[model samples]
Target: MLHRLKEFYDGPNKDAKKFYNLVEEANQELYPGCTGFSKLPFTLRLYLLKCLHGWSNKSFTSLLKLLKEAMPELNIPPSYNKTKSTKIDACLNDYILFRNDHKDDDFCHTCGASRYIQSTEVDSELVPSKKQHRVSAKTLRHFPLIPRLKRLFMCSKTADSLRWHEEERSKDRKLRHPADGLA
Candidate 1:
């Protein structure tokens, strides 16, 4: 599956507008010292879209070369070590645009952890603990954690988290420490 997908990303497409536009625009301008048309031998627009699909930087270039059909002119972005901020921004924008098109807002997006809340008013007779301990991003403002808890899925840095860790540590200390200090 991975190999097949990689091939598709690097595959040639005569229908690519960006590539044609760049080529046409370059010839019209015919200006020197400017890369109006891609110096790349093959169409990079397809690979650019695929690169946004979240492949590793190395894999992206590897697949690009395959689709480029050995077009030495298919100048994809350089390696991360030599990467420039502007180029990165462009890559990210392309990725975001591609991603946005493929995403469904109504569907369960995997932006963060998955949680389901079920509220049931249990019978007051049988169950003892009436207190609810679970937290949710939806009810974060009501919780003591406030702003920090608002990002429940990514709340490792929250101030209240320290309290929880501290409490757990104390519990461990109790288990480790013997009443008679025999060890």
Candidate 2:
């Protein structure tokens, strides 16, 4: 298991090189001129495997375990770390443009209210703790929009209309997309 994990991370094989190249491009763009070592390659590889190969969160955690068992020297992030995945997913979402048409109000569209406070009785019954406590009550699984947009750009068979904005791209372009008009 350790040998296989190291092969995937540091081997000179074609697939390993491809993985290295992907991480290289991402880190170069994210931290220009950064040449120091980082654990990001491992993290990004996990993320890519999940995205490209459709690995579930549980599967991802298992991979980390295998890597740890084999290497015993790696610093894999903690299992079930919500913040790690959230930060990576947020970075991936930055390039996406929202297409939904909605009013700019804090109120919910369905309830037309500013907030939906849960009942204190229900909260106490569920928590049953005197001291304040925090818990993650929900997790949302979403297909990131930016990668879908990037795939459109990668395919040579796409219509020219998709690249129409490239010719008119400006260094300081303003209000070029609907999102730019958002408050």
Candidate 3:
């Protein structure tokens, strides 16, 4: 199924060819010696399970340590926190996204709301502080889409399934899948 899909993508369509090449490159990086999930290494399988179950880094480390004690030759996988993510401070009142040019701004331009939580301590004659730690009033966590989409095409089974509508769908007048219906 994957071979047929690859052949179809490798045809005259330059965009499809580029997508196939990118997916192949990502697959090589993600699964080096393995072609599919069944052939993946024990450590990789554990890591996938850890990601799927949303296991904490500390919990995963503890599990790996226990596994190492039982199986001395077990290869330790890299940390699960390798995925890139960004946290942006947003306006609490106006719901304005403070990013890029407005990243360093102290207050929201739209609502005139302070970006950081107000300090509650009163100024005293005895104590004088130069700076106070500022916490964002609201934060938005962002995860990149391209890397995640690439991951979806990393596995042969997943890649084949994703392209099923284009590669394996019937060309007749009957509709079998959702892709067959006209929008």
Error of 3 at 54 (Å): 15
Clashing pairs in 2: 2-70
Q: Tell me how many clashing residue pairs each candidate has.
A: 5, 1, 0
TM-score of 1: 0.20
Question: What's the true lDDT of residue 170 in model 3?
Answer: 95
Candidate no. 3 TM-score: 0.36
Off by over 4 Å in 3: 1-86, 93-95, 99-101, 122-131, 155-183
Q: Give me the runs in candidate 1 sitting further than 4 Å from their true place.
A: 1-48, 65-69, 73-183
**Clash pairs, model 3 backbone:** none
Candidate 3 accuracy as lDDT:
0.65
lDDT values of the candidates? 0.40, 0.49, 0.65
CA shift at 137, candidate 2, in angstroms? 17
Best candidate, TM-score-wise? 3
Candidate 1 residue-wise lDDT, 1-183, digit = tens: 998899679655653654455444323321234344333212234445555787676776566556455644444434432222112111211222112343222222334222324456777677777775432213111112332234353456564565554454455345554432437
- Give per-model TM-scores: 0.20, 0.30, 0.36
Of the two candidates 1 and 2, the one with more favorable lDDT, higher being better, is: 2
Q: lDDT per residue, candidate 2, 47-159, as tens digits?
A: 78788998878887787778768866555554636315432111112332111232223234554433223334446666676554322222233334554466466667573
